[model samples]
Target chain A: MLEVSNLSVNYRGIRALDNISLTLSPRELVGLIGPNGAGKSTLIKAILGLVSFQGKVQFRGKPLRRQRQRVAYVPQRSQIDWDYPVTAWNVVMMALTPSIGWLREPDHRVKQAVSAALDRVDMLPLRHRQIGQLSGGQQQRVFLARALAQQADLFLMDEPFTGIDQKTEAIMLEVFADLKRKGKTLLVCSHEWGQALSRYDRLLLINRQLLANDRPQVVMTMENLHRAYGQSLQTTMGGNAMGFSFC
Target chain B: MLSPLLSPLAYEFIRNALIAGILVGILCPVVGTYLIVQRMTLLGNVIAHAVLPGLAIAHFLTIDILWGAFVSGLLSSFATNWIRAQTRIKVDAAMALTLASFFALGVILITRLESRLDLDAFLFGDILSVTVKDVWQTALITGVILLLVKLFYKELLFYTFDPLGAQAMGLPIQVINVGLMAAITLTIILGMKTVGVILVTSLIVGPAITAYLLVKELHQMMALGGLIGALSSVIGLYLSYFLDLPSGPAIALTVFGFFLLGLLLRPVCNLNRENSVGKKLGKKYRSQKSEVSQELEPDA
Candidate 1:
């Protein structure tokens, strides 16, 4: 379980994330959704302590920062340098570095974990290929494998579905289902819409503040969308598709 | 055949220079691999140039110049980070600003003090003039750096490849970053004697990039780059000895020469693999096209 209370992030003099509070339970998949610059990523960063914030985030009754080893984060695809000279195996092996201890080689068990993670994502065959040589879907799968290899209780992913192929999407959905079955907690930041939103047990609609946090059907209301997206939605969507009919 | 090379090793100065150069060759590229991967080669140049002020201050304060250089180099990097954090100026622009100001300050201090420090020697290192003590210092630094690198390779790799993920995993990313900066500064300081500040970036970036063209792993790049660096230094020393060229420039040019060779040879070496993969894909596409045509023939 994870709890975030009174979390606020400021960039320069501007408030990027207004006072926000939320909690996530085990075996739940929560989707974080909002328009661009809606502090979705910032909120995640604040929770992960990647950015400074004025709030408290606790996991399993301890400060989240102190319990970082029990958390796994999959950053946005754009955040990584694809040209980095690392293979999928190397990328996944990074998850076990802390456990392997300093100056010690990865034992048989460590390598097994890495290979099993890659195998779970159907990427074991391409484990030795350079990350840059992999397709976008393959790259995302590699990162997913890396997160899985971490064997963390809480999973935080940023835009895991963006620019990925359908096969990757299906694989991710299956993996998420499996993780939930295992009682793991996942908070995914997404830009998805329509029926796709129903896949989440709950959706946190945000735009600098927590607009709504409830079942996907309850949170996908027109009023909630309008409150979070504001007039930009009308401008971007030409005001004709204002109804939340798709969901 | 080997007499010409063996003859140079007989001179004490030549032997010391070779020892120092070889150590520098091994050290720069190992540290430089981090720079190349992070796309922070310019930062290496900035730190190298930033050492000038430290050297001048060290002379004025009558302390070891290496300490002064190391501190100043680290300060420059910190200053760059501070500027980037406080303002909207990008990292590259901040580095440029920091590099220019530090170099200017160093020049002013050197001129105002009328110090005995030779600016020419600092700008263009006189490798042939190195003493036994310098060789010993280089060896110690090399040993310490290699040991640290071996111990922390995984952490460094993780941090370099994915800082946020490493931080999220409780790796103390800030400490890792500062450690890397310290290592880089120490390497730049070591290189300052053999390659000088102006040409040191070549030693730091050149061999690593050369190896990058040939290898697909970070450790491989460092290993191959170390080999290339050592080879370049030895060859450059020989060229300088036989051709009567400046030692620093000769070495720098040798690094460039090796980089060009790597670039040229990379394509030829990878061609076979690429061609094989390309042929397989070509066959698959052709088969798919034929199958589609066969299916369409009945419809037509």
Candidate 2:
């Protein structure tokens, strides 16, 4: 379980995330949705302590930062350098880095875990290929393998579906379900809507602040969407009623 | 056939230079690979130039130039970070500004404080002038860098490839980052003896980039780049000996030549292979494309 209270992030005197609070229980998959610059990524970064922020984040009643090893994060694909000359196997092995003894190579068990994780994502056959040589979906899968290999209790993913093939999306959803079945917690940040929106058990609609945190159907209401998207929805309805209706 | 090579080995200066060059050959590319992967090759050049001020100050003060070089190199990097943090200037501009200011200060100090410091030796090194102590220093730095790299390869790999993920995993990324910068700086200082400040970046970047074009993995790139670097040093030394050219320039040019050759020849060589890696990659891609299309169908 994870809890945050009074979380605020400022960038050069501008409030990026303003006094947000939320909690996530185990065996739940929560989707974080917002318009561009809505602080979804910033909120995650604040929670992970990747960015400086004023907040209290706790995991299972302990300071989250102190219990970080129980957490696994998959950053936005755009945040990584695809040209980096590493194999899928190597990327997955990163999950076991904290456990490996200092100055020693990965042992048999480490290799086995990496192999099994890679196999779980159906990427074991391409394990030796350079990461850059893989497709976008394969690259995402490689990182999924990395998260699976972490064997963490909490998973925080930033835009795991962006620019990925449908296969990767299906696989990601399947993995999320599997993790939830195992009593793991997942917080997935996504800009997607429509059929994909129905998959999450709950949604946190936010724009610089928490607008709604409830079931997907409850949070996807027009009022919450208007609050998050702002005047754009009004403009759409005034200019193109059909378009607004489709939305 | 081997007499010319053996004859050079007889001279103490040549032996020392060769030892220094061989060590640089091994070290530069290893560090250079990190630079290339991080897209910080320009930072290496900046640190190289930035060391100039420190070198001049050390000469004026009659202190060890390596200490001065290390301090100035660290300062330049720190200054870049400071400027980026405090101003709207981007990293490239920050590095440019720091590089120019440091080099100008170094030049001013050298000209005004001491005219007989042999600035050329600092700018463009004289490999034949390397002493036994220089060899020992190079060895020590090399040992430390390689040992540290071996011990922290996983953390380094994770951080460089995915910094946010690494930080999220609770790795001390700030410490790792500072450590990486220090290692790169130490590498630049050690390389200063053979290639000097001016051409040392070539010694670092050329072989690594060349290896990058040929290899698909980081360790392979480092290994191949190391081999190319050492080979270039030996070949450059020989070219210098036989052609009566400046040894540092010769070595730098030779490494550049290697990079150019790899760039031009990789595709041509790939064209003739039985199971060309590129073709194999294409085959795998075609299969992935079909899988993607099949899954994309609405009914699926």
Top-TM-score structure, candidate number: 1
Q: Supply the global lDDT for candidate 2.
A: 0.86
Q: How accurate is candidate 1 locally (lDDT)?
A: 0.89
Local accuracy of candidate 2 as per-residue lDDT tens digits, A49-78 = 999999899999999999888998898988
Cα deviation of A76, candidate 2, in Å: 0.6
Docking quality class, candidate 2: medium
Residue lDDT tens for model 2, B188-234: 98887788889999989999999888777788888999999999999
Worst 10 residues of 1 chain B by lDDT: B291-300
lDDT of each: 0.89, 0.86
Q: State candidate 1's TM-score.
A: 0.94
Show model 2 residue runs off by greater than 4 Å: A234-247, B268-300
Q: For residue B133, give model 1's deviation from the true position in Å.
A: 0.9
Could you say which candidate leads in DockQ? 2
Interface RMSD of 1: 7.8
Share of native C-alpha contacts between chains A and B (below 8 angstroms) recovered by candidate 1: 0.67
DockQ of each: 0.45, 0.50
Candidate 1 lDDT, A70-140, residue by residue in tens: 88899999999999989889999999988898789899999999999998997775666678877788899
